[model samples]
Target chain A: MSAPGGVLVIAQAEGGALSELSREMLALARRLADETGGMVEAVLLGENLGDSAGDLIAFGADRIHIGDGAAYTAYLAEAWMPKLIEVAADAPPAVILIGHDTMGADLAPRLAIRLGTTVATACVEAEFVAGRLHATRSCYGGAARETLSFKTGPCVLTIKSKSQAALDRNNGRKGEIVPLAADAVQTRVRIVERNVSAAAGVRLETAAVVVAGGRGLNGPEGFKVARELADLLGGALGASRVACDLEWCPASIQIGLSGRTVAPELYLALGISGASQHMAGCGGAKTIVAINNDPTAQIFKSSRFGIVGDCQEILPPLIDALRVLRDAKDS
Target chain B: MHIAVCVKQIQDPEMPTALLRVDADTNKMMLTSSVSPVISPFDEQAVEAALRIRDALGEARITVLTLGAEPARQVLKAALSLGADEGVLLSDPAFQDPDSYTTALALSAAIGKLGDVDLVLTGRQAADFDAGVVGCGIAELLDIPAITFARDISVDGGTIRVQRVIENGHEIVEVASPALVTISHEIGAPRKASLRETMRAARKPIAVWSVEDLALEAAQTGALGARRVLEALYIPSRDIECEFQQGASAREMAQNLARRLYQANIL
Candidate 1:
């Protein structure tokens, strides 16, 4: 069979709205499809995720593949990989785009291994040149960027979150949904239970605003200020790896090369020194405000606006001001 | 229980490097003579996880393995200091700069050389490159079940119950023994090295194995045998310019920021 002149965007059901990264992929894929005269195809994997199909179509997907089963209710490599391989074999998309989130992080490499293709992760930008996919990624903790070209087949790339803007949806568009058989393959690993932290609010990946604390917060108690600010802003809370390492914040809230990558409209860095690892994770933020006593702190290099003062003195007043503004708007 | 942990030696990332050179022809990063190497951070987590498991199981034995230059023995020593029963170094000039796939094959061969191993443990990803592919690649090569980004793991009735970190949450997975697990830093905080343990590790013999000893062909590993090639490397230029917001009072700076946010329609 001839190769499918389309891009396959893997979507998750739980992370609804096609996710910012998937939307960004669609935007990039749409450009690729326009150039290649191919269609943009989306693959949605989850249990009972049919509700999300319409959004994918609106975002420029010409065809959608839905693989729904209890096995996919949570991510299981044993289950997800086989289904994805089947879809890829049947469709034979020239390129497969995945998010840089944890699922994409695990699935992309495994899928590339199984499909015998080359895969690139944490891609800041990607384009098709001379029929080959070239992806640019941050290396050495965002201190460097390298453009990599794949000479292999079925090029798979995971775009870093917030690297590309999500395409504006065309409201009335609809696409084809092809359902796959999930029970055909036996899974070696069985997910017996799922424990999601109830305290985790407004997932950092999807949040529009994020308030992050660092080691400058001093201790675990200092995180409350960042948390309160996030809560007031109706956003999520984040921490530098140091804060997490100090046990001041949970690992889930950590943002860095080893933690979550967030692309928020506003990122308030409270006392973060902005190490390369930490900067790489938040480079996507549209606006960064750094609060630190050290004027020479590296965080200022990446921040659009910086405050040279202790977060302890700066945060409470900012939080109060935001609270006033919010209350004024509410009233 | 027999647990095999894979470790790697890498240049300390947090250290300030004055200069680094890449061979124009070979595309290899050359560290300055002043540069010092330490155990890869993720590998430290792997060692800690193995040690914890050994302590919990009581009868378990932990063996640490690595492949690199002679100085790579430092990683094995660190592992030994952390309470590993033995250390094995697969040091050979040819193993340098192997792609993830080739490295996986070589490690799999080394594991095969080690005889009956019940569980293979490795860090989710090495600090260098951060490809996060080796453990999974090894599992693929061995055709064994592998779990990546394991935050918590327990041995229950001969089955490995692992908590795998997903995008927004975690899932509890149960797989039979002889499976491979790649642990994340979330597994647990690493233990501190003590003076006594450091002295003990100095005397702990590290068995060295080469490609010839493992019966692996030189053509099977390293850059020549690798599937992927780094076409180019360059430093990323920072676009945002830093302007020091110096003011007499913290409130004054906040006022300026609030005005800027308002001007930017962000307030």
Candidate 2:
């Protein structure tokens, strides 16, 4: 099979095209296309995604393949994988990139299976060399890095969350929006209900500010301070897996190798000791601040700034100060 | 009830770092030959869930299947010692490095060869790659219902009740039998194999099958059958500066740290 002359950016529209990660992927795809002399095709799979194509075009997509349907909305793997396969087959792209979310992790491997190619997940970077695609990814609990390459076509790679900077829009560029037929994929595993986390306030991936709790929170009640800070900042609340496993917070709020990865503008680590597994998930954040009573905590090693104090006493005053600062700015 | 749990032999991720080799070319870590291979952590949970279902149903049979090199027998023995009634090892050079889709198809073939099975269980994701797709892929191939990331499983009547762990929370789902489930660590810790049971497992017979015996298509069972291609792999550099504070007076040091905390706007 001949390699396609374009790159396909698979967009998981959980947060719509305005999502920072989608914009980042679009920017990365644009760079890859410019280097390889290929067009950047953004494939948006979601219900009611026709309205989002213009937004994608502004971000540098040369073509858009919209797989819009009810089934595409909630990310049913059996339904979405086949659609991706069909899109790749119809207009085979040299490479296919996806966001490293739950849907991407599930779909990439299945798509690789159907296409007989290599698929790398949670990739932090990629490039083309000698007609081969090379990607850098963290494996083995983030202990090491490995550069993998494909010997075949339609290489599938999922970019880790918050690793790339969002691309600035082109303002007036427009792309061709091609509606692709949704392949018939019969799945017995139906998603009957999707209950979003109401307590977490905002989705971790898209949040601009994130307030994370850790073992120092002591217990569930200790998380209230972190939650208050998140609410005050209009950010998302996150926790270490230990906190989640201990039932101090919902698993969705956990930020680690087994939990969600966030790349917020400001990440507040409260009582987090910063284990490697936990650090791997948050390395993409622009700036990190650590507050822990233990001055020797490992989190200070990763934070741009560090504070040695009890989060309990420190968080309340910090929240008050933020409130005053914001009120002053608004006034 | 007849349940089949697919397991894999994996390097112990928690092993001490001094015993592993880093692949110079790919920068991937290679387990030292001296390190022992164990059943994947998640797969052990799957086996435990299968045993629970068997105990609940009064009369049930459990079969464990693994597809890998011949050395995978060690893992099969471990599974048998953990109460699996029978074991099947699908060994062939073609089975090596087959991506998730091919592995699923090959495992499904092995299951079909086992005759009638009511439930199939596997780990949510392998520890090595952490790609949680096999159970769902097998479900797609068999056209059966599948619940991924299941923390709890039960059999009631002709249906299976499972608690699925999602991002923020969990859902209690009830599906009909002949379903597939991928168990997670949250399900329950796997029971240890007693010395007596381990010795007994050594005497137990393990059935071996080849790719030809399962009748899997050559095109459907290798890297050529993979749909996704890896573009590249590279290790990320860590910028960590370990800072240590040494002092004798606890109160004095605490006050000094407090001043530093205030300066950093943490207090």
Candidate 3:
């Protein structure tokens, strides 16, 4: 029952390889493809994506569209957009999904404009309602959820990270790779240099656990305890928007409306008051554990477990005890 | 060179989540009167980016532009108070509730009507819809090159250098005039409009143009031009009943919680 046009998940390569979100997009695309009785297709736009098609196929893509070029090594919207549009126009899938991260934010709208279509950004979920494909996206800074249905086919979408669990890779899975040439174009915007300040440790989006600190931590010094706990748990350390704005931590690790959205298995919020904007980002956590001195903090309402205590005092013993538990496991 | 900055006024994004109401019948989130509207924070950043160019250029004209009803003029004046020279408001009943595509259509039309716009600026995304599309949409419509998510920007002669904020580090992009740049929160903290400037802004006339003035048909723009429609909007309910841990001391509490977490295999 395969349809003429399948689902296309635009895969982005960061530092010359496919990003983690691409896997998640494939996961969601596979789900939607199953629901629509269509094939799941993926397109990789990069410089040298070696054997990426095999991995993409193993993950869920039935076919791969590879757009390779030196210009695509680093993302230049003008350089890569035309190629993507060409691919989309050729396959003209029923739906096209892109990650809502930096690349997608820059590329999706332009593609929509070029294709004479519209796009939905920061979508957390997707579904079919009344026999039409609908994307559920966060609105009003995550205070409200809105479902939108595209008026035209091959709807362009930018998928938010951490919205779906990535599928397990199966190298045995079968898929076909079709290479496409994306011509480079001269444009007003020229990227002279790219200096990436890589985030400290584990990737927040893929981490099973996250330890985030907020302004209530008082100062940057307080993040030390949060960091220790994060390290002990083998997870990523995060900060709320205010803490990031206050320069207590890097902006990249901020967990809030404008920052990265994470839905880790266990989200431990330390000294964070849980503003709606911050909650909007981490609302997907399987278990939210809040540790703050203020018992009345809003985070307590959403947390599955709450501890009314100072993070500075509680975290040290907690970390030590967790270390002891690890020691026991090793013994 | 004259630069136009697109700004929007949205129901306060910082409003507590519980107070935000959703009307099931209309499938819309109602903007309650309790929380007054404010300029989307990033749009304020966009105004700041324009003001910076104006500062460096000695006496460049900065025009603040917006597409909405009358109340939008207030936010436009807020930009004017930040050292903009003029304000252009695109007001029409047809402009209400348009998605970013239609919104961009109207704004680009207004920008085109303004004529000789050397540069354009917009917030990375509107705080309400949280769709960061209008800036690029306008660039596409106007056929101008766009640099998005700029953390820092500086203009030299006809070329502008923007330290674009990407996921990892940053990229130093150089784009020529007749371009557009989208401002993110990373674009330095926006300065508040001073009282003297705010009072002076009250006297400055803000020009209001409708769809007719922009040579745009009402039916072909705004809601009609919107490429997508909101079918339903609601709050996802949280059903978790938190388990509050209590103990004689912090150490005991930590110990008990660790034991329970370990027992549950979360550890």
Candidate 4:
């Protein structure tokens, strides 16, 4: 086998387009590749993701490898692992980056196991120093950050979403796209059903402004205020793990280290006490605004701006004010 | 039907943030050493998910499994109190420092040793490691169809229907028996055990298995089998003091905050 040198990203696709996390991982890969003096490549697996290769290259991929198959349509750890391992063997990259999403979470550890490495997931930052790669990931439920390094080359990482900026697309630049087929795929799982949720407004993962509510909102009924505020601002609604645990919101909207990571321009946390676990997910936001009744809540430390008050009393007026602002901007 | 539910005992996540300490030099997390360990909240939910399935199916045997030190017996006992039929604990000094992969390898071996499992259930991820890997890893190792992020599951004869939470929406999937499923928080909390059941749980024998008993190769089961190395662990230092808006009333604070957000260009 050839000595690994370049960085390869597993560009996972959702809804025909590459997932936002895949693009973000590409950005990180580009930075790492540039720092380490290696090429940034991507491996995409799907039946009809052939056109998405352009997007990958535009983001910084020097080469794109597509392993297209009908069996590869849905995310099954059993199907993608064999193909990804073969891809790495065929062109051994020094670093293999996979997004820490649902599919990535399932696929990365198993792939790392197959390749004789342990995977570091939910990594917020990574750097290559003197040819050694270091990753900083949150552990202990986001209360602490753990920096990891491989004893050998070919470190596999499951990157957190929204960790880096995607490079501006340049149609002028192009890279190599290689089509490879898995010699064999032993798949046991089948996606008997597939559904794409119709989000009322902006998607939570990519929203520029996020309005998240926590247990202090009291119950599922509390989300009505949050949803109204989100709609008025054209933002997205998110929930704390507590709210999700309490069945106040969908687990899909959980905003924490264990859930989705968002780097929105502005994050308005309503009634959240700002647990380290929750802050780990929203730490990347340009400006975090936290609202809680407790004056000494831990979340206030992570927030750039905080309002100490009852969300029940404050939210309605806040929504009214936002409506006035939106109405003014529209006019 | 026979089901295997994997659970773990973890440092209490609900401890006040001030009580948690990080040691970067040793890469260690100190949780005051006073917070009693409890069943990983998610895995506890998984135990409940299995019991719920048993409740629906009727006459199903549930085996609670854990791969950790002797203290992990508590997680098994917790599962038993919730009505699981039996318990299994995999413990050995060599099993120390097993990454998610090695952990999955050892757990899969135990499950295989148990034999005739109609379904395997575990939390979406352990709260301690929070890697969310072992369940799917076990499925891959066993070559069984695995469903994750399951909100709910219902069984009919030998078929299983699961409602899975996807990225944005929910999808209901149907599968044949002998499949693996990782229960998410959406499964609802496990049933609370009565004092009577808790007493009976104390007497429930937990079968302990060692790495040698499971016959797992050293190259495949513990620190020797791990792939990644931890270099450092630390609490990230804060940067900027949080500016709190002062107002006599909640409505006044809302108004001040709204104007301030506009001035800060965060609106």
- Highest DockQ, which number? 3
Q: Where does model 4 exceed 4 Å of error?
A: A1-3, A14-16, A35-37, A67-72, A151-153, A181-186, A219-222, A245-251, A320-331, B23-25, B217-220
Q: How many backbone clashes does candidate 3 have?
A: 0
Write the residue-wise lDDT of candidate 1 on A115-225 in tens digits. Answer: 876577788888766766678887666666667776566778888877887888897887898877756458777778887876568878889999999988988778988
- Per-residue lDDT tens digits of candidate 4, residues A1-331? 2233889999977667777788888888888887767899898988777468888888789998887677677666776777788788987888999988777776776677677666777787888655578888877777777778786557888888887777777777779989878444755555677886676678887899999999889988789988988887779999998999888987778988667788899899999988877987888888888899998888888788888888899998887776776577679
- Worst window of 10 by summed lDDT in candidate 1 chain A: A12-21
Evaluate candidate 1 and give its CAPRI docking class based on DockQ. Answer: medium
Question: Can you write out model 1's per-residue Cα lDDT over B1-267, one digit (the tens) per residue?
Answer: 888999888777675422545555765556767878888888899888888777778778888998887888888988888888789998887887787777787888888888778789999877766777788777777778888899988886589988988755688888887889999988877998888888888887789988899888888777666766677766555658865565577766765676566667886
What DockQ does candidate 2 score?
0.29
Poorest 10 consecutive residues by lDDT, candidate 4 chain B = B23-32
- Global Cα lDDT for candidate 2: 0.75
* True lDDT of residue A223, candidate 1: 92
Q: TM-score for all predictions? A: 0.91, 0.83, 0.96, 0.91
Sequence-dependent TM-score of model 1: 0.91
Tell me the lDDT of model 2 at A133. Answer: 72
What local lDDT score does residue A124 receive in model 2, on the 0 to 100 scale? Answer: 83
> In order, what fnat does every candidate score?
0.54, 0.25, 0.80, 0.69
Task: Show the colliding residue pairs in model 3.
Answer: none
- Which residue segments of model 1 deviate by more than 4 Å? A1-5, A15-17, A35-39, A171-174, A198-201, A232-234, A320-331, B17-26, B202-205
DockQ of each: 0.52, 0.29, 0.77, 0.55
Q: Model 4, DockQ value?
A: 0.55
Cα-based lDDT at residue A285, candidate 2: 79
